[model samples]
Each structure stands twice: as structure tokens, then as C-alpha cells.
Target: MQLVFEVCEVADGNPVSTVRKVFDGVGGVIGRGSGCDWVIHDPSRLLSSHHGLVGCREGRYFLTDISSNGIGMAGSCERLRKGQARLIEDGDVFELGALSIRARLMEPVQPFGEQPVITGVPIPDDAFLALDPLQALDLEHQRQSTSDELEALSAGVGEPGAWADRHAADREQVAMPRRVEPANELPRVDSGALASPSDDVFWMEFAAALGLDLGKLDHVARKALAIKVARLFRLEVERLQHNRAYEEQVRLISTLHSDYPG
Candidate 1:
């Protein structure tokens, strides 16, 4: 069994419509800082760099307040003082700064054939864009565990600013002037473009509507189609992190998968 935390919307604390992201391991710090286990990108800046720590004790989970602003229960007006700790149960919702998050214990399952595994080695910039999207899909699925994904991104991306450069370059080519706020709404993409959908269901539907047999496509053709899909997924994740779309990010990550026809 693993302890999972579902982060609700940043705009308003509510349950996520999709499966809640499940982070592996016992528990760790929750904050806006990159170093924290749970990195929350809060645009309002209400969350501290090192907000609080979620730790396991006596076979139960506990949240400790370590931030300057403090943490609180979902409906309570009171917040925990720095250094204070509270016992939390599965399905308990709490407030960390402005973000509302729910916690629950879940039995681990391999949604894909085997557990989703992300490679630790960094892919060069030239290769990052060219790498197969199906492989990228596998890595993205493995990202449901917050620590595993962040660690891979932080370490596997080689240098500090390389990831940003790659992202900026991709955006320069396809990004629009204004931003869209809807969680499920996809950005404006060329109709002729390949890999338009973020959800796997949409991918399947998209492939089916076009009467494309993904399994039969040549390697080069499949790679061409999947590259854009990979780019879309990566860009969407970056957008969510930057906008502090916590709920959307969680849903996107937890549900990301490409069920390629066998």
C-alpha cells in the first residue's frame, strides 16, 4: 500500500474530477520550492519555499507545520503554528497555504503492462525532441510519483537551464500570445499536426478517426506523429507548473498514457 495525496484546485479547494496522483515512499516536505518533495507552483506566492513536512508515524501519516504562513485543516479557521504536528488519516483534506490537498492510502497497481519506469539518463536536446513519443509516454506515466519524476527531471536534464531552453524553443514554434485557463481545453494546434490529444482516450479516438493503424505504421511515420504528442505533453506539464494549476496538473499526470495498438 502507498500513501497518496490528491491536490485540489488552487482557485478553489474541491475534489479533482480524475484520479488523484499517488506519490511513492513514506512522505516528505510540501512547498513551493523545487527542493521540496511536493513542489507546488503557487502564483499568489502564499506558499513558502519550504512550507511543511508530511511524515509517517506509528503506521499513520502526520503533517508538520514548518512554513512561516502555517498550515490548516480544510474547514478550520485555525492554522498550525510552526513546529506543530497533526495526525492525518486517509481521505483527510487540509490546507497548505492557499492550496487544498486530500490524502488517502491506496493499493499499488501497474496500469500499464509493467510498472512505468523513467530512464535516469538525460536525453540530449537534439534527442529530447526526436525521441519516440511512446517512450515519452512511458516516462510521463511513471511521473505519477512526484519524487521520482522531479528527481528524474532535475537530474536527467543535464544542466540547470537546459530544460528551460528546450521548453522555450518549443514554445517559440507553437505557442500563442495569450493563455487559456480551462483545464481540459487544449491549446490551439495546427489541424494537420500529429499527436493533438493529452488524454489517452483522445489519442485512441484521434487515431481511430483518422483510420490510422498505429501498429502498422513504419518507425519513421510513427515517430513523426508521436513527437508532437510528446511535445504537447511536456509543454502542458510546464504550463501547469508555471500557472499553478495544481488540480489540472495532477489529473494530467495521473491519467497520462498512450495505449498504442498492439
Candidate 2:
């Protein structure tokens, strides 16, 4: 599948032409010329000192910042630090310097129980053909007229009356205060005050109860078991605290009673 990208300049708002320029430049670097099937660019060099990589790999596209400056991912568990390759997902927001790029993941539609087929269409030679001479002349005239109007407006501002008005406007704009929303507060945890058993101790007791040989299991499997046991214990404690009867509790109690034979 062809990797899709949406690019924009850091200083300007989303302009289609500017985005197209960056995409086209980067596409030439990796897509058409390089043997590599992916296109990745460090956009930081263009607008800011920050550096990042944007590319696709094995049907997945990602934008990661690995510069001295950092990139922030909105609502993410962790801020992507330098040299960190964060897996991009649909609607993922990446902030690099003053610019933000939002990833819009597009999945190819496949027939039920079927793999998606990639299509390659050849470009037509006529696509690059120039416009008629008269049409080109008219377009040039329009552009010159627009430029002249802009120059006239810029020249008019040099007048005393215009200069004074412009200065006052600039001052007023600077004097206006911007309103900002308060940051969302996180829950405060006092680690010193909380009494919680370590996972190692709990896992040892749980493994003893289950009669499992810890030495026989791999480290990954043991960690998985510890997590599962911890979750199960937490669920049982919550149920008992709420005075709820759970079948697992009854089964455990019956098993213990049978072992004791009392």
C-alpha cells in the first residue's frame, strides 16, 4: 500500500500548496529515487531546529521526533523524547516546536475474509502539458495586478496619518491579554502513606497457593502470572469490600476446606 502523508509549514496555517511542496520534495528523496519503499523527512530542518522522521513501514506510518528539542503527543501516556520512535495511530497529534501534525490513518477496505490488493496506476504524459499561450498571459497579468495592489497598500502605510493609526493598532493588539484555560490536574498520591505489598511477595504467596513450580516457568510467563494474580486479588478485595458474593471465592473456600478435611 502507498503511504499517505499530509504536510504543512510551521509558521503558516494549513496551506495546500505549501504542504504539497514539502510532500513532493520528500517524495522525490525516498519514493521515486531511493530503493527503500518508504519516505521519511526531518521537517524540523525546514522550519525549526528540531528534527523528526516521518515515514511508513510494513503498512504502518509514523512521525517521530528524535532531536535535541522534544515533541509532545496529546493525551499520550508519555511525551516522545529524543530518539524515541512512537507508533503513530489514527488521530494521533504530534507537536514539534510550534508546529503540530495530526496523523489520519487510512485503512484499505478489503472484502470480507480477503486480503487487500494494492493497485498501481501509470501517470499520463499529457498531465504535465503546458496551458495555452493566451491563458498563461492572462494568468500572468492577474498576478501582476495583485502584486501592484499589495505594493500600493504597503506604500500608503508610510504616510504620517496611516503610520500613526498603524502604530496605535499594534499597541492595542499587544495590550490585549489572552485568556488561557487551566491545566487538568492529576490525582496526588502519597507513596509514603499508602500501605501496599510488593508484587514479588504477593506473587510468591500466589504461586504457593496455586502449587506452581516458579523455576519451571519463563521470566515473561512469571511476570504475566504476577499481573493476572494481582488483578484477581484486587477484584476479589473490591467484591468483598462491597459485600458481593463471587463464585471464585466460594470455589477457593471449598478447595481449602477439602484440603483441611475439617
Candidate 3:
């Protein structure tokens, strides 16, 4: 049976749930013990070391609760015990101490939100391809096709002319980076000054401004995406905390621009 562990509750300092596959097979264990196939992470000290076991027999999924504390199952009045192997089906939610994960046969359902909570980013449908590194950075960065690069791929390659042109183009891009509007300049950092955009403290501040608790996020990539999305929200908001947040956002945008430049 396919199952996913959706974090219904997070303990203090717990990172947010990462999009990951915990188990593929039918048999597994859910406990605090290291030997268990799926180690239970309980911050409340509620679950015992050997808590529960999951297995499949006759194409039916079942869970055996062995902990001193009862294991709660959805739609069941009474909890399952060691002797009683509770039948698990799709939409089944299992509770082990403070953490409860919903089990399903497919991908975990996205949480409810007015704006789509984007967990995955699809490739651009424009089908834009990059032939060079600088061209990849800014698609609009106009350039003429080099003859040597073409010849190199086809036959004995072009002369030293091709290599020289490519090297020159790279230098030009660095010398004069195209900037956009007011946020063109990257946030400046000074010695012993306040936290800069590149510093970890800035991101922490950014998260706080956006109400993003880093401890609630588990995956690094998801944490990065959260920051990106939060900045996108910051760009649109007219007021924050009953006051104009525009000034703070300009500084925030400076940092954001440093990370993502056109």
C-alpha cells in the first residue's frame, strides 16, 4: 500500500515537512527506535521506543500498535493495540503522540489556500535554450552567433577566434551588468554594520517579516522557495503591521535583487 506522512502538527523547532517518499513497500515500523524502518520523531516524549509496526497481508494494509499509549486511527472509536491489527485504507490518518500523519495512496494533497501553494515548478513552456553561460543568465541579453563555436561542434573546430570572442563576451557581461529600476543596485554590506542580504541574519529577518518560521520547514529547497514566495508577496503589499512597509520593502528588494538579478 502506498502511504505518505503529512505533518499535521509540528513540534517547536521542527522543520517544515519536505516533499519526500518515506516508504514504498508494504512493511515498515513507526517508532522512536533507530531499528524501525521509519524512525518516529516525537518531541513530546509521548511515544515509546518501540511504538508500532505496519505490514501488508492478503493485499490489505494493517497497523499494529504496541506502545503503552494508544494509537489513534481515524473513523475508529477505540484505539488499536498489539493484539489488534487495525485495517488501514486510503485517507487513513494515524496518530502517534503529538505528530499525526495522514496516509494516502497518492501524492500528499496541497494545503488549502487562495493563491496556489506552489511546491513544484514546471519548466518554462517557451522552450528557450541556452547556448552560452551569459546568454542563459539574461535571455534578452542580445548577442550574435559566433562562427567558431559552430565549427567546433561540426568539424576540427574554428580557429582561436572563437575562443577569444567567447572569453571577451564573458568579461563584458561582468563589467556592465544590466540592472532594473530602483532595485538595480545590490544591498551593500559594511564591516561590523547591520546584517546584509548575503548574511544569514538577513534571511532570518526576512522570514520573520514574512511570518515564515524556519524551524517549521524541513527541506532546504522548500525553505528557499518559501523565502522567494514571501518576497513576491512583499512586493505587492501596500501596508504591513498597520504602517507603510514600502521603505522596508525597498531595502528588502535590494537584497532580493542581489540574489535574483536580470
Best by lDDT: 1
Per-residue lDDT over 173-222 for candidate 3, one digit per residue giving the tens place of the 0 to 100 score: 77556675695778876443553457566556754443333433334543
What lDDT does each candidate get?
0.63, 0.49, 0.56
What tens digits encode model 2's per-residue C-alpha lDDT throughout 8-99? 33444433322321221111112111221232243333322224555344444545553434677655756776544566676666665545
Candidate 1 lDDT, 1-262, residue by residue in tens: 5678777646544333332445453556676666655677776778887677665543455677867677887876767766766777787787876678888877677677687787896756565554467867766665654596587666555333545666767767994669767698669864435544564455466554323335444445555666744554465466558668877787676666433333
Candidate 2 lDDT: 0.49
For candidate 2, list the clashing residue pairs, or say none.
none
Return the TM-score for candidate 3, rounded to 2 decimals: 0.36
* TM-scores for every predicted model: 0.38, 0.28, 0.36
**Highest-scoring model, TM-score:** 1
Clashing pairs in 3: 15-216, 15-217, 16-216, 16-217, 16-218
